[model samples]
Target chain A: MKSERANRRMMTRLSIFAVAMFGFGFALVPFYEKICEVTGINNLIKPAAAVVNTQVDKSRWVTLEFDANAHGLEWEFRPVQRSVRVHPGEMIQIEYDVRNNGAKAVVGQAIPSYGPKHAAPFVKKLECFCFKQQPLQAGESKRMPVQFVLDGALPADVNTITLSYTFFEVKGASTAPAKGGVQG
Target chain B: MEAVHGHTNDHSHDDHAHKPSGIMRWVQSTNHKDIGTMYLWFSFTMFLVGGVMALIIRSELFQPGLQIVKPEFFNSMTTYHGLIMVFGAIMPAFVGFANWLIPMQIGAPDMAFPRMNNLSFWLLPPAALLLIAAQFMPGGGAGVGWTLYAPLSTQAGPAMDLTIFAVHILGMSSIMGSINIITTILNMRAPGMTMMKMPMFCWTWLITAYLLVAVMPVLAGAVTMTLTDRHFGTHFFNAAGGGDPVLYQHIFWFFGHPEVYIIAIPAFGVISQVIPAFSRKPLFGYASMVYATASIAILSFMVWAHHMYTAGMPVEAQLYFMYATVLIAVPTGVKVFNWVATMWKGSLTFETPMLFALGFLFLFTLGGFTGLVLSIVPVDVQLHDTYYVVAHFHYVMVAGALFSAFAGIYFWLPKWTGRMYNETLGKWHFWLSLVFFNVTFFVQHFLGLAGMPRRIPDYALQFAEFNAISSIGAFGFGLSQLLFLYIVIKTITSGEKAADRQWEGADSLEWTHLPSPAPWHSFETPPVVK
Candidate 1:
């Protein structure tokens, strides 16, 4: 009877420990994220918003190249303008055309990449079509606009930045593309 | 000299000793020996299934072109082979050993929880079914490696769900089984047997059971996250949704690295017992052997990142993992030293059991050395995803754990069956296995060094000759196991009757106190240790 009591007590304790380990496994998710943030290893966290330039820099001109890619998606995507030259403090607008070529409607999400990667923090998007998912009807075509200003604090020696957007097909869609977008 | 005690009062219940005949006997049985038998048979069956998958893989690589299976099916073969062997073969076979030997070794009447033991054994079959059935589902079995790194695991088809569910069930079974073992070992030892005085096998199992309880649930958690990510739109591993895919690797190796020791420590226990019995001496450094095993288990957790060296981490983290991984060799070296010291200058016999244990020693140490080579971050990155890594693990898994299992089986067959196996046939099995196993794996190291990657169906013409030789060796090794099956069957049915004490050097309670073909119920009154 004494050993029986001990066995039961041991079993209960071990069971509780096993349950805690299961929780620990899930805990690893948030714990791993926190470590990544602290160590900046695989940090996907966005950089803090930069201070807006109060004074316009009139002397510097940077060339911006617009590029669009449809990754494994049945869509025709291209930028309307090849490139634009602008002062660091001037806001500029560019348009991209995307058409669903498939028989059925599809949703897409766009991701942006920058060349000379250090320029990423200096270029800010004020208003962009990529802020939300775009759902296009079969054979529907739309031109979406991106508006942004380069920070006047952009590195003085860097005179060119390439902005590219890649669109991936989202498997299911419940939202419509931008309303009142310019038709190309 | 040993005394045969009066156990007249030990057999208090004739009903408990009486074994029922038929399928229901195993279906509803609560006996530890019966459950142990079931575990051995189940693992043996899984071993064959996983072995066939290996042959398929070897066959495809026999000539450096896609000859038999498609690329997808080939990937599936590799994935399932690893899963089946680690989970379904090596782990359970040792549990089988623990079941059959622990209660007898520690002078317990039975496991602490007999009904729970039955539940644990029964859970394995359905889980195995789920794993095998996964291959037939739409979109084929998941080709993600056994670690099942996510994003790929999340995007894999319906079969991935089946694999995940199977992993969950297997984790549950392991947890319950470990709980039962821990309780039985801690609470049921005979009157005079202190923790320090318990048999080496029992001590190793005690540590292994704790490791299992702690990590099996973590594995369940990893798979559960994978499951939710697949269906519920959780971006736990999806980078597009702000989750880093590398996080999955971190969580998996956290469980996976400790999992390596869960399979090896028991094999160490087996060798610790077998090496002494054949050498006709008490184990060398018994206390040190226990300490080394404990230290290895504790160290297993800290060095998981070594497996991910090529997966990319900060330079400081890489350096830390590299040093920590190589540090495992110190305690592992202690175990090897103790086994050899047990044999040094002692009168030795070359019985089948001793032969296999020696084979485990020579080959496992070789595996350990290669593992040390891999621990250096720069070297591992160079050899990453290569046949060299493949050869290193096979040495550990097959020659290390499987060979030790063979040693334990040969060592204890007489006690379990009350008949001696044919010595000549067993020696034949060992020699053939050793020869063919090396023939199959040794050249793979060279192939890896020459820049051949693993898990591919084809290789450059430069790697062709070794691949051909390796395939022939693979077939030879696979066929030699049939001879093992024959020897085991012949021993069980028709071999010569054995003495109550089969080995002169075996000093465990099972030999000194219990009769051969250990009774259906043993130590019921608890033999007092002196």
Candidate 2:
């Protein structure tokens, strides 16, 4: 009887631990975001607007290469410019040309990531079409503009950054506006 | 003390009653031994089911070019195969060992909560059914790999929901089982068996149960989120709704990395027991072995992102994960070294169990080294999602865990059944498994290095030759397992009776105190350990 009581108590404690760990798994979502926000690992969501300091680093020339891909969607998507030379901290603008080649209209969401992921924090976007869903009609072509400034604090050893986007078809997204205008 | 004495009196009285007959005996059994037997048989059935799926995959890959199965069907096969083998086969098999052996080893009467023990085992069948039933769902089984990366998983058919539900059930069952184990070990050890003096197998299991308690819920949570995202308009993994797909990888691997150790630590316990027994020596570095197992569990939490290196984590995150992953080799190496040291100057015999242990040590280490190679960011970038990754895990999972399981079974079958197995057949099973296993996976390393990706229905012309060889090896390996089944069945039916101490060098209470074919009621009056 004594052993049974002890066993019951321990079982309860262990079950509680299991329950707590399940909550911790959900906690990991916020925990992961916090870690990525601080470490700048896979944090592609645009950051809050900072004070516009008109300072540009003239000594470093970084090549910004743009790449675009469409997955399981009938669309022609590519960067208007393959690459651009920009000074660190200089504000720049570029466009990606996308056309819906299929007969029917479609919705797409562009997910972006920075290569050499160290540059993700420093490459702040001022305006970009990737911030929302894009709806394109048959034969409709659009030039999506992206405006961004690279932080002067980017490490000296880093000289190139690849900004890539893959467009995925969004089901049931046709209810939203065809052109959900840019946030900026 | 009075309560303990009263319990003994009650059990003695209860032992004389007529036992439940026929199927009711199994269906209503609250006995640990009965539940343990059920768990083992269930796991073996899943092993065969999963093995058949693997052969199907291998046969299709023989000549490449989509000859036998469609690409979508191939994806489903790979996904279900991994899920079944890992969750259905390996995990439950080890749990069966714990249920059967732990109380006996510790000199306890039975599991702390036998009813819960029964519940846990019973939960497994429905879960297994759900997993099998997934293949017949309207759109077929989940094509999303067992890893179930988000967006891909989110886009899957109705079967994905079934898969998610299956994971939840499996996780619940594992959690309850772990709770039962932790409670039994902590509260039910015989008087005088201190924590430090407990058998290494018990120690390994204590840690493994803790790991299960910690990680199974995390897996439950991940799948729960997958469920909500698919049906409840939650954006846990949908980027458009502010959830990041990479976040899903982080959450899954958090559960996943520890999961590798969950399957392995008990195998370590099995090897630790077998090596010392065959060598006629006490385990070398018993204290260090305990510490090393604990360290491996601790470090598992830190290295999860290694599985996601190609998913575009930051340079610093990659470097940290890589270094931490490589660091696991230290404790793991300590374990291997100690196993060797235990056998160095001691009398050694090559029993079937020992052969499997040696195979585990040699092959698991090879898998570990390849794991180290893949830990580097550049190498993983090249090898990620390739056949090399497939080869690496199978080495660890199949050669490492499955082989050790085989060793444990061979080592303990005599005690469990009171019968001696055919030595000749046992050795044949071992050698064939060793050679064919290597033949099947060894060439996969080359295929991976040559840039052949995994999970594809067909491959380029260059991969044809090695794939054919691998398919042949796979068939050989599959057929060899039949010998194991035959040996087990034959031993149970008619074989030489086993002595109380089944192995000459075994020192555990189960071997020394219990009679062959241990009675239904073991340690009714708990034996005091010294």
Candidate 3:
């Protein structure tokens, strides 16, 4: 009888040992993962403030000035002093001061996408005017501009077309980036 | 204790009678049959739920251009479908089989920990609920794909948190279950049933459990970092905050790669058993098969970066991962060769189970070949995240793991339920799934080569015809599973009687003596094996 009791105890101890071993197994890999995170071997996530910047590469530079156009159509391209001779592969920056001169806010989305029929190859986006959703407060304005490289491989025939965008208010405007340059 | 084979007056069955039927019966149950039934049914329900999610995805992907859902909702479908299939469908199905067959095969009375077995299985339902609940959360559900990469997942909404919690629970469940398997196989084999004498299924699962215990926690930790990065302000992945996003991929694949093996090992176990029964011979290279399985499990840990080769890893890291990925072909090739050798000159017949096993052998090896091609560094450069990758995984998951599981279920149904499934309908189900499975996925390889990608709402016109054909096949495959549900139900409700040795070629202890349609409580008193 005592031996039978001892056998039961032995089984119990064995079972506990088994459970402990597996528990150790279960916990060990995750502990390694935690170590990976601490040591940054796993490179876990970290949050930070939003930032934006731009610098011009002199080799790939062209400039256009849409100097102070105060009068135009209800919906018109702000006139620019242009007709400049740019090499087939020269990148150009279009700088313009844009505004919502109307009484109500003007809202719009900027999609910097490739081509009329997949015609333009989007080399890359350095900084897009579309990063933050834009809504011009009533009688508000801002400088909405873009800079892009015309990859040296741009075809010679497609060199003279005007690259343009039109900003129309979304039915119900919600963001605050559109309050840039309207004089009260 | 309940008598295993219902001879309560015999000395071997002494003091083993009268099983309690209420909840306490389960709480304190040591009966392998009872535990097995619980596992099989739980896995079945999870399969049905996960299946419904698959249909939702197929229906939306049926024609592209955002037919029935928004992009976020679409992302949710993809995420949940993967998560559910891995955890809810495949893993649970293997566990169910393990609970039912491991003890019998080893000639043991019960698993090592009876109470913990119940707890581990029960934990599954709540974990499943947490995953399903994420769909209804404010942000719909997790949309950063199933890998849940760092900055994208960390910046994701509350849905990701729920996914993390769900992963934690699932990992715990797998760990617990793995431990139970290890202990049962290690300590409880009958006196003469040494490691070499054990059945192939038991051998395969023992290795599978080792893989599971080692990796599930790695998964838990990967998700935990995602959680803390979001809530605790840690910069583990945020580059702006001194964290590198690529590190998340490294950590995740560390666990994720082994996870693929964890799912496959049990399926390998199932197919190993089924092939022999149908082949009318003992398994060839039993020792070699065991060694190969162990080798595959170890290699799985080293080859994870193959998945990340396209994430802009350094050239040296890429080369190391590439060669390591290719090395997998050696052991995996050994397994296929052994399976074929077992059937080489033997009297082979195609039972439903054997057909699925054969299907798994042929197609999984095909998938592995494509995997070798994919592991090549230059080839992966173009194929990563493309339709090619989708085809590779589907071949393994659906054609390989899932088909082997079906073979196992059909092979063992008679022993488990004491009823014969209608062979005619079983054949029809098999053929339909085979035909449709090939039609759907076989064409995806070409589309991938031509640069079609996954997770897209639309595609170029050149890829349209193949996409449409694949969609139709997906629908057919989806519909065929209903036939499977019908077959299972009809067998339980109305099939004819099953014999003690259901299959003449069967050699395992499961068929050596236990009656068909195992009792509600079985094997409370251990059997002696030689």
Candidate 4:
């Protein structure tokens, strides 16, 4: 009888631990974002709302470089303008042209990352084409625009911030050859 | 006195029982031993299945120009091979050992939850089926590698969902099994067998069970998120949906890093028992060994990001992970030193089990050292996703965990089967496996250092020679396992009789008290452990 009670208690404790760990797994998403925010690692930068600072720092000029890569997607993706000189707190727009070179219509999603990762916090994206999936018909081409403002609070030491986007083919969005041929 | 009276009452209740026989016995068995046997057989079958997949991989890599299988199929083979071996073969093999031995060692009638034990074992078959059947699916098995990093996994075919479901089922089985182990170890020890006084195997397993419960659910959550992202329009791993691909890696390795120890600590237990027995000495620094195991478990959680050094983590995060990863060597060094000290100045015998344990000690340390080297951010940046990483894990996983498992099987087969195996054949099996295993994995380190990337079906001409040599070695290792099968079958069918005390130095209750082949229901009347 005593052993039975002990067994029940242990089981209960173990079950609770299991459940807690499961919750903890979900907790890691927000925890991961928090850590990224603190450490400025892995391009997991949380976008901040645009700051309306009346005073602008015109003395400092930072170069914002645009880069694009398409992984396993036969889409020709490139930034229209390679690099731009912008003052702190200045809003700028850039265009990227993408064409589906494949035989059928395709859906693509662009994922953005900022290099000189410390600068990720200051480069706020007010409106970006990366926010949604872009579907293109066969032999179709489209120009996508990203509008962003560099916050005035940007760090002094960082001069160059390279924003790169890699477009991946989204599953279930492409109706043609949906099953087998997609390579990672 | 009350315990003694309870034992008498238990004996009287069992006196008139008639045991079931034949197929029905196994199918309906709530007996721990029966369940254990089933687990062992199932794992061995999966071992062969996974082994065949490995051979296919080696065969294709022999010439490095898509010789046998296509690149996609090759990817599938590697993915399923890793999944099947880790989940289906190695984990279940240790669980089989735990089920068969834990109750007897603790002087208990059976696991605390017998029916749940049966359910856990049975859950494995369907999971294995789902995993295997995935290969025959519309596209193929999951080819995003065993880590199943997203974006790639998101683009995979229908088979990916099957793989995810299989993983969920496997995790469920592991959680239940862990709970059973924890309950039995904590609550069901015989009277007078205090926790500190228990055998090292039980202590190691108790720690392992805790690690399992803590991490398996996390793995379940990771895969479930993958399931939703793949099918339910969830953006957990979709970047366009504001999710990061690296987050999948972080979550996966959170479960994955502890998982390395999950496969390892039990093997440590097996070696701790085998080393002392063969040396005719008590285990050295018993209390310290337990503490070291705990320390390794605790440190395991902190070092997970070491696997992600190349994933562009912050330099500070990399430095922290690197230091914590290197700190693991301290406790691990204690374990190695204690094993050596146990064998120091004692009458020692070179039985098959001891030979494998020594091999495990040597090769596993080499693996550990390479792990240390890989933990450095700069070195890992160069070596990540190379054959060197491949060689390093096979050293730890195959040599560290698998070789120790062989040692355990050889050491305990007589007790389980009531007959001695052919020692000559066992020695031959051990030597061949060691030689061929080295031949296979050693050269791959050079290939990796030479900058040959992993997961490629075709490699540059410079890598051809080593790839060919490694392929031949893999074939030799695979063939040598046939000898192990024959020896086990021969022992079970007919062999020299085994005594209750199979080895002179074995001091555990299971060895000292049980008959040659332990009875169907062990310790129905529990022994007082004094």
Best by DockQ: 2
Better of 2 and 4 by TM-score: 2
Q: Which segments of candidate 2 are over 4 A away from where they belong?
A: A42-110, A113-124, A132-145, A149-184, B1-18
| lDDT (Cα, tens digit) per residue for candidate 3, span B122-227 | 7888888998899998988988888888768987889899899998898888887887788788777777788988998998899888777766766777687788
Model 4 Cα lDDT, one tens digit per residue, A45-128: 234454667366789899999999998888899999999999987778899999889898877778777887668768877667
lDDT (Cα, tens digit) per residue for candidate 3, span A113-138: 23332223423323445444456665
Tens-place lDDT per residue, model 4, B11-76, is: 643422544667877777777888888988899999999999999999999996777887889999
Local distance difference test, each candidate: 0.88, 0.89, 0.73, 0.87
Which residue segments of model 1 deviate by more than 4 Å?
A44-72, A77-98, A102-107, A110-184, B1-10, B13-18
Which parts of model 4 are misplaced by more than 4 Å? A38-79, A82-93, A96-110, A114-163, A166-184, B1-18
Which ten contiguous residues of candidate 4 chain B have the minimum total lDDT?
Answer: B1-10
Candidates 2 and 4 compared: the better one by DockQ is 2
* Clashing residue pairs found in predicted model 4: none
Better of 2 and 3 by DockQ: 2
List native contact recovery per candidate, as a fraction of 1.
0.65, 0.67, 0.00, 0.63
Cα lDDT for residue B245, candidate 1: 76
Q: Give the TM-score of candidate 1.
A: 0.89
lDDT of 4 at B208: 93
Q: Which is the winner by DockQ between candidate 1 and candidate 2?
A: 2
Instruction: Give each prediction's DockQ, rounded to 2 decimals.
Output: 0.39, 0.48, 0.04, 0.39
Model 3, residue B71: C-alpha shift (Å): 1.3
Q: Looking at model 2 chain B, which ten-residue stretch has the lowest summed lDDT?
A: B1-10
TM-score of each: 0.89, 0.90, 0.76, 0.89
